[model samples]
Target: MSLIILASLVFLLMPIFLLLYIRSYNRHKKNHFLEKLNMQQKFESEMLQTRVEVQDQTMQSIATELHDNVGQLLSLTTLTLNSVNLNDAEKAKKKIDNSLSLVNKSIKELRELAKLLHGEQLVENGIGHAIHQEINWLNKTGAYELKINNQLLDVQVTSPDKDLIILRLLQEIINNIIKHAQAKHIQIDSYLEKNALHLRVRDNGVGFDPNEIKVKKSGMGLNSIYKRIEMINGKLALNSAPGEGTSISIEIPYP
Candidate 1:
């Protein structure tokens, strides 16, 4: 009777043991596949970023050539044309004046292109200084009031990946506030907390439902924000509602 009882117990346990074993095996397989997928995706993202950087460098080179070579040639050609001696002296003076005006205009355009192409000011002075300068410039331009809290002002952020990520994140936030927020006031605060960099960008503007907006066809922008944060193993929070304000908080881990 005891032998028969033991046999029944083993029979009852066999299916559960098999099920647990299969579950573990499948979980391991899923995890392995997911790791491979993540690796492939990271490779693709890096490649795309490299391509974009190359394209940007090429564009800057073209812009420089246009301003330096083409613009200088135009100015020199105008001067040479003006130096020409003509029998109609009065008409020649008028034409020379016109050419001089054209040259001056070209110089102005070249100066602007130079500003855009050469001086980023972001790399030289560091990201914090650059952000403050940009915020100051923005505030000076219109009815926009910007408040920047720089807790990490004296602390140098030398991590290239982190620096680029923060800059991109801030740029997107500022662009969103400027384009969509329609707010009179903006606030940005940053500091190091709990072994991570914390940032908040807030504005007194109308807000939308994150759920509704994130699912739309034009969801690329929102997805970009989330994906970038995810790629860096960071955390992001959004606070907003209709007729209320919007605030975005981001936290990037150290090491």
Candidate 2:
């Protein structure tokens, strides 16, 4: 009788244990689904923010180019035309020629500005070409000695969202250098290896302590870069010192 009772108990406990396990498994599945949904929402939010920042940066570049470049050229052309001595045919012809040259230069600048206006489209072309376009614009500034080895120009694979974020990250880094680095040389290298995309930027700028920046939550847009890299599951290694300059390396999974 005791043996029969023990077997009966064992059979009853088995169902309870199975029921508990099913309940626990279902709970875990629900939690995992919710966690995944939250992550998807966060990634979408970051992408939206990245899009806005890219647009804003493009607009700012356009405004600056218009004011500092096209506007100045047009103004000089106006002045030249105004000073033309129509009474002296030779002098009048010379001033008119100069004015025409200025107008042509202004047109060229406007065309370049138009290219910048299509910032989103540039990224759509290919991240490699987008990067080259950015470097060209920076080169035009003649602010730094640039050594570029961008091997992505012919790369066929792309991730549109990642491309935009990467471009903005580069822009932010260059902006930080322009505003605070006070360094004269900048080097950019980008390539693909071992199923990953790598980007490295080194500047001979007045560097700072990364630890101090983290503690103080100070400038250089380091925090922003970190957050974006995390969003894309990328890794960044930043090295810097007071007089040693700054170098940043980033690696991300590719398409």
Worst 10 residues of 1 by lDDT: 115-124
User: Candidate 2: misplaced stretches above 4 Å?
Assistant: 214-218
Q: What are the TM-scores, per candidate, against the unseen true structure?
A: 0.56, 0.94
Tens-place lDDT per residue, model 1, 24-108, is 9999999999999998788478546634543364355446557665567686767768676798788777767777777776776
Q: Global lDDT of each model?
A: 0.69, 0.91
Scored against the true structure, residue 139 in model 1 reaches a CA lDDT of 61
Per-residue error at 211 for model 2, in Å?
3.1
Candidate 1 Cα deviation (angstroms), residue 25: 14
